[model samples]
Target: MKKLIFFLLLLLAGFNLMAQQDGGTYRAQLPEITMDSTSSLHIISPEPIRYVDISSHAVAGDLPEENVLRLKWVPDSTGNLSSGADNLGVVTVIGQTFIAQYQLLSAAATPGSKLAASYDILPQHIRPLHLPVEISTPQLRSHALSLLARRNPSAIRTAKQYGISAELNHVYTLGDLILLDITYHNSTNLGYDIDELRFKIEDKKITKATNVQSVEIRPIWQLYPIGSFKRSYRNIYVLKKATFPASKILSVELSEKQISGRTIILKIKYRDILEADNF
Candidate 1:
């Protein structure tokens, strides 16, 4: 019995030793992007497009802290985050509003090297509520100069400022149309496609037909392309002037899609409502 017990203990010890020697740090998957062997920018997401078996892969979840998963800054190459092939890209994979970018600077991009092998791979931003809407640019521009300004931004309002900057430009109320001009600037070097855009009112306690029939831009609008670094978009809505009271809240809700993770609601104060020609 002693001899059998000793043999079983030796067997377990050998298995444990093998397990320690078997797995080292993960050999991270190489990014599809390639830069000037010197340096380049990238954008990625760890959310797999296809189902991944986490048991076998060393993904961002398996990694501790932000060490191996995040990008490393190479200080010797460039002065800013763009240089040194070392300054890694910032990863902000927003499902609703943004698709941030990342970077890969290769000291000398060798397939097996550490620097060139890593980059960001983001999942496709999903949006469910897409409205069927189109704009007539000719008519839109024609009405711009003559239209009565209901509300124009005195100072730029910043909606979301991390990876993307959304600014409110102008708001005009024509005879039967409301024109909204918004500029979205992408600060990240990577590109993200705007999945879905929706326009609606948040008034839930309304019991009157007057408020319902007031301003009419609902359930249909788009904000140019979310992919562009700097895009100025216009939402020409058919709207009528309701009550230009001393103050009011127009919930201008704009977002990526179903995900409420990033939503912007601009409560417009119609101080300019008094500036209308009718007044």
Candidate 2:
């Protein structure tokens, strides 16, 4: 009876030791990233990883926001990667689980390439995950300029509508003297007084004033239709020349209010030459 009791106690001890070894918990190990443009590489541990809390480093300046850490597999020879994500500093394992996946991006390899990665582990907040990858130079060249131009169609339409027209006659430099030769015609049969003539340059409202000199005008026909009767007036206004450092755009807008109707015309011109240095 005593021997049997001792044997049963030893069996129970062995069972407890085995259970401690298989503690029902394990951490997924980081996998080696291999460079292969033909296939995507993935590392997955059974544990669920949360990406929202991961720390990320962004390149300085105005960069395209779309390319920010969206799972890109760059070639191994592309030098220092522009951006990467840092692991969330710590990972908790409830049970035995491990999973990870890396999707590749289509880009050619330059010299000195590397794979940028982010791994989330505990204690240290964010950690940079990097792995050496091998890549081969691509044989085919791609034309990206046409693709970029196609993406921005609105700019093309605006250029076509508001671009320089052939009606511009004078070539003026920045800070140069210029003269505005404006002509106004009274197209209505009944005599009407001109209230104001407003000139706007470069989208800026310049001046609005009445005619200071006295003027007389007579209608040729009783009631002038399109080409029936005629009345014309001309004014010379002096403008100080201005220079733009680079190629600048100048827009001229004319606003006239008469007894009959109000008319407005806008003209845009590009100035490439500099006329004056002093402001």
Candidate 3:
């Protein structure tokens, strides 16, 4: 009976030890960061900070910019916030695309006139939660403008409808994106009110009564914001780089607001996409 009681006690102790070890591994091992109560620490992120989890030992506030975070530590009267990891505070900064974690360590104040340290959260540091890669909107717009300046031969894929001419001027490849330069020439006096500008992949030939099967492609970005234009107008559109069968065709359809409801479609072939110039 005495031996059985001792064995039961030992089993309980083993379970308790395992539980503590599991708890320690629950939180990720974060990067260690050092700061002192005598100074301020600033952290900046490339994207806006959507959520922040901070410890109670420190006071944190956001600056005017949504991407910046300010942190300051407050110590006890003895000028010490224990050296143990349990007493230490942590900071977790989350963005739309990535997450960052830092373990704050209390350090002796450096000899200076109230020092301030800044840290930037770069793309290479964080784990991308949802996005595969970081994309810059401004860079895309700038590159699109540069492509528009290039000289290309007269367009072979074009269509005319009611005095309006739609032309697919050039196709360029940038990274995983396809940039297209489209120009609309209005010879008539009437300005064109654009109702819709759409892209799609459709069958090259349609039967008399068969249902038309088409897949619409949405542009990731476009250069212009105008609703109406006169004379000659040119714009750049961006789409994800893709491929289609030779029997399929890429179509750019432009429609005007109803009343006159003028419409034009510019068809591009798979061979044209294969010949896209690199930007």
Estimate the Cα RMSD of every predicted model relative to the unseen true structure.
19.0, 25.4, 11.0
- The Cα error of candidate 2 at residue 158, in Å, is 20
Q: Is candidate 1 or candidate 3 better by TM-score?
A: 3
State how far residue 275 of model 1 sits from its true place (Å). Answer: 3.2
Each candidate's lDDT (Cα)? 0.41, 0.30, 0.78
Model 3 compared with the native: what TM-score? 0.56
Better of 2 and 3 by TM-score: 3
lDDT of 1 by residue, 202-227 (tens): 44345756465334345222223333
- Give the higher-TM-score candidate: 1 or 2: 1
Clashing pairs in 3: none
lDDT of 3 by residue, 1-279 (tens): 999999999999999989878834223476666666666789988866778888754555566566888877654522545443333467888876788877776655444343438788866657767755535555777888887877868895888889999888988888888889999999999989989999999999999887888999999778886488889889999899878999899999999898879898999898988998886
What's the lDDT for candidate 3? 0.78
TM-score of each: 0.33, 0.23, 0.56
Q: What global local distance difference test value does model 1 have?
A: 0.41
Tell me the deviation in Å of residue 21 in model 2: 99
Highest TM-score model number: 3
Candidate 1 segments whose C-alpha is farther than 4 A from its true place:
1-138, 144-156, 203-216, 219-240, 244-248, 257-261, 273-279
Error of 3 at 35 (Å): 27
Per-residue lDDT of 164 in model 3: 96
Assess candidate 1 and give its TM-score to the true structure.
0.33
